[model samples]
Target: MKFNKFSKCLQIGLIAIPSAFAMSLTYAQDAGTRVAVVNSEKVFNESNLAKAMQTRLQNEFTKRQNDLRDSAEKIKTAAEKLDRDSAVMNEAERVRRQRELADQDRELQRKQREFTEDLNQRTFEERAKIAEKANLVLRQIAEQRKLDVIMQEAAFVSPKADITDDVIKALNSQK
Candidate 1:
């Protein structure tokens, strides 16, 4: 399987739930406990910079795949031509073709390795930056809303409430 399918995105749920009877944030409340919800997925999906980074990574992978395929095709064509003419071909020509094929194989392997490492690094770095920024904005929004607690929408079983737009607004304003 490709690394992407196996590598799930990192999820950080920042929840400041009031400590119940003893929960820290709970106050002398006859009033219901205040809750704030932020949808991290939504924020990630909406970020323009994140989207661009994803597209760029995909394009890089595509280019590598195309180049590898082209190289393989050239090697295959060379082999076929050699097979047809082998009886009459000089030893030097045969050796040259074999050497070229070996070089191409080595180059393809090196490129695939480079792409895997580079793509994974870029993905991690970009995601970390985006997640950090989104969290910063979410925290600011929760403060502005006077929320007693803030939680990631997904982590909440029923998501008692949603302030995703508030978080998004805060994120937008941040820029």
Candidate 2:
């Protein structure tokens, strides 16, 4: 009698598990999921925020760039003068002039290196600000449209689901 009861319980367990799995699958298929895609690169390239950042950086660095160019030109002129007059000068004077030229060259290189580092740091900061604003705009769009998911980078995205242009427009509208 115990053996018969054990067999009946085994049979019922097998039937119940398969039925439960099938019902869950059917329910998932019945529910529709909404999805969207955004091309972040396109938004960054086309947005007014990015453009303004570029302009600001150019303006900030222009004077420093021009000054560096002028210093380089002065150094070049001094080097040519030394080359031309070295043969006519006494040994001590020639050595002093050569040392001065080398010092100036080293100082110029140091300044150029600092300029490049400053430019790179500023650019990184501006890009971060743009990304922060873009994320806020993306969240707003997703909430407004009732989107379940918004993918930034994808291998393939249908045009029907692309909201990149909308993102650009929203960014342009903001200050």
Candidate 3:
């Protein structure tokens, strides 16, 4: 009967699908999938290059930071003096000093904004450089170790699968 033939075909198809899946799974296991995990935070923090870069940025920005600090101190001193002298100061003198204080405060704020923007930009640029260098080293390590996949961030990675130390070593070696 046609119904019987159709049932037989359906049974054969069902069996074939499971067999195909089993064969593919067997093939994949035999092919040896190698996976690795890298802690990018570790690589960035522990690398010699990153340390050097940080030191360089700190040194480069130190003078500007000091200048800003000095400006802030001057503004604070001026404001304190105005507050103390206002009781004795003439109307004209008090008004002039108040205006000067306001101007200085505005200037300080503008400088602070500029300094923050500049520092942020420089930090972003340097961090990008560090990341680029880390990625290059990561790729080299992966290729050398014959890794099929290297994860940057993971919730949990066994010590055996973590290649971050090797990556840090490579980064340090580049120093």
Identify the candidate with maximal TM-score. Answer: 3
lDDT of 3 by residue, 29-125 (tens): 7999788999888876778877887898899899999999999999999899889989999999999999998998899899999999989998889
State the C-alpha lDDT per candidate: 0.72, 0.90, 0.89
Identify the candidate with maximal lDDT.
Answer: 2
- How high is each candidate's TM-score? 0.58, 0.72, 0.78
Q: Which stretches of candidate 1 lie over 4 Å from their true place?
A: 1-31, 55-69, 79-103, 153-160
Q: What is the C-alpha lDDT profile of model 2 across 9-65, one tens digit per residue? A: 999999999999998777755775467899888876789988888899999999999
Instruction: Kindly indicate the candidate among 1 and 2 with the higher TM-score.
Output: 2
Off by over 4 Å in 3: 1-32
Clashes of each: 3, 0, 0
Q: Return the lDDT, model 2, position 172.
A: 93
Better of 1 and 2 by lDDT: 2
lDDT of 1 by residue, 1-175 (tens): 5666545432111232222444533443545666767777777777675677679878767887788788778878877887888788899988887788788778877887887888789888888888888877766766776777777765554444787766666666665
